[model samples]
Target: MSKIKIMKKFNFIIQSKGGAGKSFFTYLLGIKHEQNKETLFIDVDGSTSTSTNQLKFLEDQKRIGVIDLLDSQDRIARDRLFGSIEEIAELSYSNYILDFGAPESEQLPALFSRDVNQQELKGFAEFLNSEFIFHVIIAGGTAYGACMQYLTDIVRVVGEEFKIVVWMNENTLLNYPKQVEQILEAANALGLDVERFGDVLSGSVFDTKLSTIIQQGLGKAGIMKSGYMIQTQMKKLTAEIII
Candidate 1:
């Protein structure tokens, strides 16, 4: 294997609410990291595996991997997840971006609520010499309440050891301006970093076209190839990401 680059951070895109743009955000972050570092994209979505699907090209190149936590009985297999973590710990250098599905998202925070799991994760981060940053989504519209609750739950469980980054989706921001403001205030009070997306990702004609390309498993290269308008939007969206 090629020498892995020293990882700076292990980023996780997590949100319990579906349609909150977790996979899209993960893809953007993966592309950003891929530009400069040896990065691994892990899709832990047992159900849809949308991130895995979108990043299939990268997986074929061995830059992406999948670890479905659900067992044959359709339950979250904790032991299997820990085993995967051990394998990743052995590769302590390359940066990892994990896009978690709704069920796995909830389970991870819950796991962090336990002291033993928290210590284990802290040890893993220490061994890798990387900071753990959870990129949680706080969207608007009908998902606002659930998203906010999930954020609070994560904060409550992860404690002060791990860093939390909030990604505010702009698609429904106008519809729930007050709620968005509340989230901003809370994030500010908590001193968590906030990133805004969806200006270009808002379901426009070009955005729809871009989404279809991504879903077709062409990844970033496809976006770059599909005309200038989509490429421009993809660039703009990726530019706004601070992770």
Candidate 2:
């Protein structure tokens, strides 16, 4: 068993409107934390729209996404799920991504319904408390404001320290083609310390190709506003901040 990397800095929450790239960005962030192995991803989207193609593509990349774990009723299964989350906190290898996407027709109603305190509900909450789960919300243009309010209410009930990420990742294969700058600028005004990254799915770079793109982009000025750029900035910026 690998030692899990317990997150030192609370949890990250990416909350946005429906089409704000929450689903894809969640996977990307989870991938970044893979080496920590203690990372967990809770889908909660229950979206059937892009499940077929997107998730399928992610699986092909050998990512440890958790959508397949939705049908376990065994106590051992629950135990495995719970233990895996905590176990990954100090480990190396990103096998700890948990997909919380339930069937939309089934679990989507729960989000709208008032508190039920069901057993499963309690278990899920327990899972979150034990695991420093990051909440990534998809904030589409029309759905942004309402989702923030809705998420605020939900997180209040859950009592988790989720860092809201307002993603402005474009879906086209150009990464940060000229138009994203304005969108990212607006996102920065939200007071959430927004982080924007290239929509890996929509970008032309893959694996080594992506690495080169990041290397070139990081050192530049104008084209460096993307999420990857911010991560680089965070490293340098935090180096002397000394928490």
RMSD of each: 3.1, 10.0
Candidates' lDDT values, in order?
A: 0.77, 0.39
Model 1 stretches astray by more than 4 angstroms: 1-8, 34-37, 71-78, 114-117, 201-203
Model 1 scores a TM of: 0.87
Instruction: Pull out the clashing pairs in model 1.
Output: none
Reference-based TM-score of each model: 0.87, 0.41
Per-residue lDDT tens digits for candidate 2, residues 126-147, read: 5544333344443434554554
What alpha-carbon RMSD in Å does predicted model 2 have with respect to the real structure? 10.0
Q: lDDT value for candidate 2? A: 0.39
The superposed Cα distance between candidate 2 and the true structure at residue 171, in angstroms, equals 8.8
TM-score of 2: 0.41
